[model samples]
Target: MVDDVADSVGSVRPNCSRSWSNSGSFDLRFASDANGKYPSKIDFHQIGAGFGGHFWFAHTRKPGAMGGKMKVTGTWTLDHERTGPMKIMAALPDHGAHTEIANYRVNATRGPGGRVTKQPGDGVRWVSIGTYMFDGVVPKVTLSSETPYGTGENDIAFDAMAFIPIDGQYHEHTVEADALFDENQNIDTAAPESWLNESPLESRERLYNWAMTMSDKILSMKNCDSEVGDCLTPHVGAAVANWRSEVMAAGKDPINHPDGNSISSWIGFANSYKDRPDSYTRPDSFDDDSRFKIRTKATTTFVSDENGKIVPGSQSASYANRTADTHLPHFVLELFRAISEDYKISLPDLGYRAKDLNEHNGEYTSVDPLRSGIIPGRAYSYGGQAPKLTTYTGSGEQRGATCVAVRTVAGGSIGYRTLLSKEGPTTAMSDFSDTLSNSQYVAQSVWELVENIREMFFDSGSFPVVESSLYNVAPPIWQDLNFRACTNETVRKVDGYPILRASWMPDHYLYHNGTAMDQSGALRKTSLPLMRGDFENFSTATIEVAHEYTPYGQCRAYVEDNSFARNKNPWGINPVPRPGFNPSSVQFCSDPDLAPDPEYSSYDVS
Candidate 1:
């Protein structure tokens, strides 16, 4: 079976979920200064201190830039001088898009001689805990010791890496459904014709410049006003070095190249050199007439120019792991931007500013956690009530609960009116419904259609009895339906006939009946309100009750023989007439006597 498929059309695989799985295993070692404890506070220079007793964000080796599932295996060993007992703990974020592969724990058991080891092993007792997937999120690890540093007892040595499984990484983009509705194939004219939003490269230069500025900013942060290497320094240094190396191999002189000694100076400064002079550039020839070139880690064989077109024969200036090289700078910029405020980094030029990074302490910062993850906030809810409404409309001055008229097709005259309000306390009241907010009206309507369809095909019992196995098979478009928990329990067609019984909220029922509000089953409670469409309704239609059949999966022909004695107006605009109907009259046609007059002939087949 095709698990998922995306097309140019708006219809998409509604319920399919994407995630990362563990690829392989690696290790983590933590030093005292990196622990953020006393004797070494995480100040400007101590970037590692920020991750002390907490998590630090970094990249992995196996997956490279295009991320995936990562299996993290490592040993957590304590490096304390006088260790009586200590706690060694490590963790990966279980929030945001990053899901924990499994629940695990590591206990640091002190072996003889103040030596800590894992259970059931020798030489530091290595324990393998996770088969994790970071997806697009930057991987982070957290560490803590029973006795923290500067206490003369707590010190930790952590060394770990993630092995990204190459396969479980790619995710298909979700389609933006704007023009069409999922049910009745309705189209909304106000919606844009095209779902795709084609954007120009408006922020290309700004983003590039931001990356450069971030590179500079990270280097400028000083502890005690002295420059020092932190976790990110090496990456920038390596990138610059690689870029400069490519320039030189292209036979470009360091003094004359546009990037010039700038990249070189950055590299040298990161490496603790006061300044790098031109003598550092080797005069050796990089050219070889032979087809084979010197082996390097570069992934690309040709360099691209400003327009992104390949520069002819510019092999020497080509980049390796081009995808990683392309995105690493952006990652640095975004990561810093997430926590920049706490560190006193200036905004205005960073494109966006974030509130609190620690709010997502154990979550994936897949660029920005807030953009992908939802944070639930509580709203004060007080009870109120509204009296029964008296309505004067096409439906005979209906005086009852609230109902809404929805136009299925844009600009068409007919509207489908469905009863929505529930019968409850007399006092005025308002609350959030299962349909969610105003923006979700379309999704809620679509969900209602699917819910009714399921009821018609399976619970109504009006059609031929489908095999029980068929009932288990999910409908193509029904996956998006949010059905009620009590639906299966309450819907039982013992008579083997249409559940015209005053309540079955079936699709066909919507065609000829109006429903009342009732709640029979109440299960779990949540912050979000229950969907009103989920409950069974109250309608005063004639019910042809049938006896409970003896065996299940009895396939029989649908209603095939009726005297055509009566017919009802399919539209609920007028009250349907009731006739002396035969309970055994198994026919698809409605009673002819109740059919609508010529003026109100048009009806929707629900």
Candidate 2:
């Protein structure tokens, strides 16, 4: 926050050194001041320069007329003198028509002296009109007629006005005589220009121009008069002194200075010459012109059955460890890791952490994502059992961090926090209290803007591809072992299309065309035949590699691979329960004749 020193009433510099006095008679406005009746003889003050067109009027007394009634309002800088009161004096032709004080308003200043019922002779006599107490060096005032003039003789003719210290009162000022302010304080004295709203080059150029103008105005020795010798020089220097004492010396930032400067330039004005840096990061080095793509990561998609079942034997072909494009899926985890590395902090990894029967008296809170469990990476499985899976639950239930709302903030950025709901048989949900920190809350506030983007991601119904080096495929290593089927290539070929092993490749995707095909050991490369058949039974069909490679060397997908048996537990026994199964440890039941025997088979740790 910038200090508001210049704006305070106590800091005003009085217009005391010289009397800001105006005089003369007859009907005249500042316009007529140079021509008609009272030609304003005083033109040296800023009152004339700052208000060139505005005027103070003087006229003969007349009732309800725009005469003898003048009101002028403007800023007045006073010397910072607390000891004495300044006197305000006004005059009129001694052949006076009664003119009572109309309205006198001076903020926190004192008094309009007793109105003069009589002045000595007809040659205009100046009486002690009003006494003004100084709140600061400068004070602002407005004066007008109390009662309208009546249709009488030419009685009240405003003659003159003056503001001066009540004789012999030593008035003081806040700024010193020799203080110097450079151009640095002029341009950089306000809020920073946002890079999102303006380009770096444009912001820099504007600042540069402002600095150059200030430099010329402040440093140049021209524009000086005999009385005020370079008036701006002292005031400008004073502004710099004020900035250093009030802001810089106190260790506050002079860039975006707090209190406004009286002069346009200051001590640190050179800082304005610095440039603003670019903020957006792009993946041009990765050869991926796609938006928000990370060259270091790729998305590996694992397809599961419609019932959300994880078949143990198919784990290897189904699980690929590549990064995703657009980055929403792994954005949080990646951000956390990056922050951890940069700050040298040991943040927890993104994985499950079952309640330890030892710590916290083994009485952990139920369904707490922060302590009890965490969803595995790439937790979002589209068109599967769980659409939103950022949150993890202690028990096997659909109770993870499900984002129901998002918010946007400055720079059009977004952040997301978890939302809890009670639906179906699950009565409990995870509230995001433990999910975000104070700083994270700021990020999540901005994240609210992602709701629209979230809708787009779901609507596309397609997975993003990233660089292949991101993930390592699981075992069952189908690509390593050739077909062990005791059969030749002739039998493996169906309708003249060769059968190939389904291996997880980098930057490759498996596409499913919403068609119904037989859940058999093998599938066809073409969807023309399958589209004609009834697909209702396969609402959530399986997808596999189509033609080993597309014409452009990209891999094509073939859905409904039924050649392999439905995956069973690696051993002949079901070792674990639903939702908590770790697909990484899955092993294939290689023996075709082997049947599950609950009593005979034992659970083995892979």
For TM-score, the strongest prediction is 2
lDDT of 1: 0.19
Report lDDT (Cα) of residue 181, candidate 2: 18
TM-score of 2: 0.17
Model 2 misses residue 541 by how many Å?
6.3
Error of 1 at 278 (Å): 43
Runs in model 2 lying further than 4 Å from the true structure: 1-334, 337-444, 447-577, 582-606
For residues 332-373, what per-residue lDDT tens digits would candidate 2 score against the true structure? 233333334432344432222321111111111122232322
Clashes of 2: 49
Among the numbered candidates, top lDDT falls to 2
